[model samples]
Target: MQTNYFYRIYLLLVIFVNAGATVDSNEQSNVGVKVFGPGWDNPQLIFPSRYFFVQHFSDKRVVRVEIEGKVGENVAANRKDCRIWTQVFNETNFDFDMIIVRYKLMSDRCSNGVIIKLFDANNELLMKKETSTAIYAEECVCHNLRWNELMNCDQNSEIYNQLFADLRTFNNSKFNFENSLEEMKRRYAPYTKSYSFCHYAIVNNEIYRKCYGEYVGFAQFMDDMLISLASKTRLPNTQLIVNLGDWPLSDTRRGSIAMPVFSWCGSDETFDIVLPTYEITESVLNMQGRVSLDILSIFGRQNGLPFNKKTSKLFWRGRDSNRLRLKLVDLSKKHPKLIDAALTNFFFFRDEIEKYGPSVSYTSFTDFFNYKYQINVDGTVAAYRMPMLMAGTSLLLKPVSKYYEHFYHLLRKNVHYILVDQELDELLPILRHLIRGKQYSAKKDELPASDEEQAAIVHNMRKFVLKYLLPSHIYCYYHKAIVEYSSLLKDGEIKVSKEMQLVYTAKSKKCNCNKNDANKDEL
Candidate 1:
């Protein structure tokens, strides 16, 4: 019984061994992928599923595969082979979106060449690829399985849709935000009121002298007159008092000495003084004579005067002409600095003329003669003829020249209309009563029958000057001249007092002396 059992066992063993060999060969033949290159252990064949390696192969049908990462170099290849077996099993059994192949260069061998070939189950070529460079020695032990291929399965995936939508929304939001900001700025700009005041003062007075002498005193006088006429007229919201060409040279001259001086004064503030460039040039010409004309011509050219245009008169002529004079007066009321600049030019011209002779060719004699003589008399040689001509022309032109005549008439009418008068004995008593805190009252349309009524009117007038007009004038003067002149004075102390005295003396001499004597003294 023992012998019979042993014989059966031996026969069974042989059958089992033969069956195993048949199964292994069948698996190798069924493989649809192959690899060939240096550094492989088995050169003739490779079992892609089993991870068999080949040392070298010449067939282009062979595919290259690279192993990466380490499990102890040689052992790493075996471990990766095991992992690949599992991946292959899963891929073959279930649906896979795609496969990703990971490769790494190997550097152990002189030429670590790799190649791979893929075939269908029927042995027909599906793909073929190769790599000339080796997997780096450090990376040769890494394991890689195809993952990127799986991403290509669906074009309309949720991840891609979300990314595109977010990108579009981000772009649109930025565009709308910018447009809203621009609309807000247009909704809030200040209201600007424009009007021109007629500035009038005696000629040759300094700013301070005029301010104290004429402007302040005139303002008081005008206030009283307005109060007297209050029953017939209403007060203006704001008054624009323009200083026509002959504005005082000083705040004191205009009677601004008692007013409080504020630091922030300019066009943006209350009062303004405008000086004409022509007036300045005229003054300069008077002082320096003909040589000043050349300086002025050069200056005019630099200032954009049309030097070559015959239709356009010479700079000084165009400037001193009646049209320009009126314009200058208008512009001076609006822009005080321009007037100051004109005056500066005149001063410089005068200085130059005084240093040079009148016969010099700074400008043509005809230009000077026309400006000084012809225009003054309207081409009449006889004094009596000129005066008669002027008077007759004035009457004739009154209707036709309404605009010019209106301003002229207004000026003459207002010239004697004192806005403020410091010298008025009546003014001092009224001011004194107000300063001493006198209580006064008045009825609508009632003339001052009592001392208290009179005091009330004076107080109101004084208050108007202090609150509105004076501040504006002082502010304008400081910005326009005081600050600059103060800086020019050595030690930064304004020589206002000394300058005032000189101005006063000059005015007195001008008023008392004859024209010829005054001219000689000025020269």
Candidate 2:
């Protein structure tokens, strides 16, 4: 009884330090489902074994940094135009080196600059530095490079030459970029609102957006993602969400959205880290720059196979855009026993048949989950279907990929998926061993290392994904990201900024349910 009393006191202390947040419920707000009787956040359910892991492990899936001091912090302070809050700012903590203060700029307004001051034990200002912001053209870096490559642009091509150009502009220009979705598009670039929806926080110095990266056009899909989050979230102290997708990776510089994410992709001087799109897994099909697509739903419209049972053969289907898909088709012709690869006509529009031809019948995404193995190859950019592919029953077989999306760090080679390397020479042999039950030398084979290790790889991977890869977990993580970002400000209020990503007063607006009418199920 006495220990319980002490524990309650400690819990109260932690909550009080949270500025003004109140813990009204054990479960996080609108997480759809809960496994641990109102107490389990998404990270806890997805990573039940990883207790020592810091808060918000879902957002840190693709990016993990090791720092000496405390890596994650929650802060609350007051500043010039806004109340500064560091809800969940991440920084490297070195013991003796020059303390470098790095964090994301989360605000409801366009911050001209930030002033950091270092004080000694006596509280005297030992050092102070003023920092400014950097602006870029609406496109993410990866989109431009890939776009130029497809157009067959030589060095003289506008996009090719401008690929690495100094497109960085400063706030010194004093551009009025903070306008509503329609207003910004009409005045500047027609695509401004789509690319800048999550571009910046300050819209007319009133609305505050959540965050932004390469494809600000993802704002709509992000809105739907947030809606899903809202349906299931039940936590209290929830800030009004207003996630317009109009921010940058950081204000100092711009980089590529090549794989929606990657390791060490930050530019020099500005240490802002860019995040990938969540649309990869949910099939949101629209594009602002790359030749690929943006999807609205997390999965497809069919009932998928359960994990315990699936066809033994590997299954893959898509348009022929690169050597990866072409090779898979060729190999399938040679070895029908292992792979079921084929080309599907992917005419985006019916009029295209005049220039192209009859479209090949594309397989339903729901069907892929029924097979024991699914091929994940790069098309236009990183394969956006990876999240769904891995979540399905099929064990993923991808080439050794240099490109990556947000949650790549959560996966392990030969465990979550098999890697077909550059030459891809061993693709057939590996397929034979796994699907046909043919044995290969332990040292020569990549997966199921030895004969004795037949089920270990699959079992381990299945367990890891089953725990962490749920839409509920994604929603829970999303809510936590906003909460952490909101914590940086005093009282986590949005009185100073414009609109938030998931606006707390969202009901007043007409919500468009991402038209995935075919997909009846919710994540």
In terms of lDDT, the best-performing candidate is 2
**How much is 391 displaced in model 2, in angstroms?**
2.8
Least accurate 10 contiguous residues by lDDT in model 2: 92-101
Clash total of candidate 2: 60
Candidate 1 residue lDDT tens string, 385-483: 111112110110011111111012222111111111222223222222322333323211222333333323322322222222211121222122322
User: TM-score of the candidate numbered 2?
Assistant: 0.44
Model 2 misplaced regions, further than 4 Å: 1-197, 200-217, 226-276, 280-311, 321-323, 347-359, 437-446, 449-456, 480-523
List TM-score per model, in order.
0.14, 0.44
Candidate 2 residue lDDT tens string, 1-523: 4224323333332231121111232432222111111111111111111111112211112122221111112222223222222111122110000111212223322123334333333455433333233111111011111222221123222211111121222112322222222333332234543434343232121223454334554455554444333322222232232223323223222322111111112232332222334454243212122323222121222133333345677888887555566667777777787888877754333454443333358776766756667878876446656766654445677776545544555677776667777556778777777765676554355566432243334444444433443333333434444433333323332233443442323233232222211212212
- Best by the TM-score measure: 2
Q: Predicted candidate 2: what Cα RMSD to the true structure?
A: 20.5
Tell me the TM-score of model 1: 0.14
User: lDDT of candidate 1?
Assistant: 0.23
